[model samples]
Target: MDKSHNLERHLMSRKGEHNYSATVIWTGNSGEGTKHYRAFSRDHEITCGSKPTIKGSSDPAFRGDSSRYNPEELLLSSLSACHMLWYLHLCADSGITVSNYSDHAEGRMIETQNGSGHFEKVLLKPVVNIGTSDDKDLAKSLHDKAHSFCFIANSVNFDVRCEPEIVVG
Candidate 1:
């Protein structure tokens, strides 16, 4: 069996149905339940199995706590994380030898006059450091494939663009 054939088989084996679940517990009672729109807090906690609970709140623009993680930020984070994970896996399979990877991701949302809004896009700026033997062009080209395979990016309606800077050390 050839290396390419083994890699193809491994990749194919990774494809299948997956199920995810999360529990969101609202923690913002403040002694009053949604008696009025302005009467309750918008704080909550998101837990998934044994992982650390993520403290979440509505965007500060919606009268939520500015110190907590907001849904919008989480959405952007999901996209960025999904892309980075896929990129790293693809790099490993392609022998890119990544030493370090970091992303400064940003997202844009446009709110309408009626208090409705939608994400316009997300830009992922990944600074990747690879081994000296790795092909920089190949590393750069892998981002497009990574974006295509990213579960979060595929599920989103807005654009998720990856502008990666590959540095060979």
Candidate 2:
């Protein structure tokens, strides 16, 4: 029940490594198959085992369908989801009873003159609602640890900043 014991148990349970995989199938081929620059579509499908296929496409700036999910948006969503999951886990282990949690994350990408671009920064604004008994300071402090442990955040070259707000409910 104590903090130290809980932290120790949490650390001990994650000693093993993990692996993940996914498949992307291009469904474009608008009957021409890249014969010209505008001949083919950028539509594709992403699948992971038995899960539902995610409709994917290039950004509309690249002549893709605006109705589909773009790669840039997916990358930002991955980072946001990873951070939120780790934060919730850490809160549970640390005895912070979170009633509600939400994040409005944003990412900024800069395109170069050569038509290539990279994400410059990502801001994760997490608003956490915790039980009245929880320590608000401790809840706020956990965001740093969560970001440090997030796999997607650690893999990205751009800076990922967390601006968390803690509310006792």
Candidate 3:
């Protein structure tokens, strides 16, 4: 098959719409139930079809529990996971053998004086362990392709940058 035709077919096959559903149940209502600014906790549960429930809360800065997962952390995790999945797929297709992968992602959000905030940027630091060092350059280069294909990174308005460390094991 011609390369151009194959490329076109591959691109067309990847075009589609995906839908996700989640239900957030508020478990923070104190007895007063928002009668005052501090009347309620910031705890909640996030549920999706048949999956285990996720305990959630606002950031501790907003009077939330420190032990629960926050939205900011979840968003960062989503971006990291999406990029990792894409990177693994590209690596396999490119003949790079990956043994293990991990990422430490960070995000910066600026809070306005009026209480609104938005994420300015996110940094993904992925440490990928491979079977050999021969394809180190190719492995590193796949991060860019993965970022381009990541759904969560593409959906966010802020910049999501990746700095990958390739390790041979």
| Decreasing lDDT order of the candidates | 2, 1, 3
- lDDT of every model, 2 decimals: 0.92, 0.92, 0.91
Candidate 3 per-residue lDDT over residues 18-136, each given as its tens digit: 78899999999889988998999999999999999999999999998999999999999999999999899888777789999999999999999999999999999999998865589
| Candidate 1, residue 38: how far the Cα is off, in Å | 2.0
lDDT of 2 by residue, 44-116 (tens): 9999999999999999999888999999999999999999999998998888999998889999999999989
Regions of candidate 3 where Cα sits further than 4 Å from its true position: 1-11
TM-scores for every candidate against the unseen true structure: 0.93, 0.92, 0.92
Off by over 4 Å in 1: 1-5
In lDDT terms, which candidate is top?
2
On lDDT, the stronger of 2 and 3 is 2
Candidate 2: pairs in clash: none
Error of 2 at 19 (Å): 1.9
For residues 1-169, could you state the per-residue lDDT of candidate 1 as single tens digits?
7544676799798889989999999999877799889989999999999999999999988989999999999999999899999999888878889999999999999998998999999999999999998999999999998998899999989888989999999
lDDT value, residue 116 of candidate 2: 93
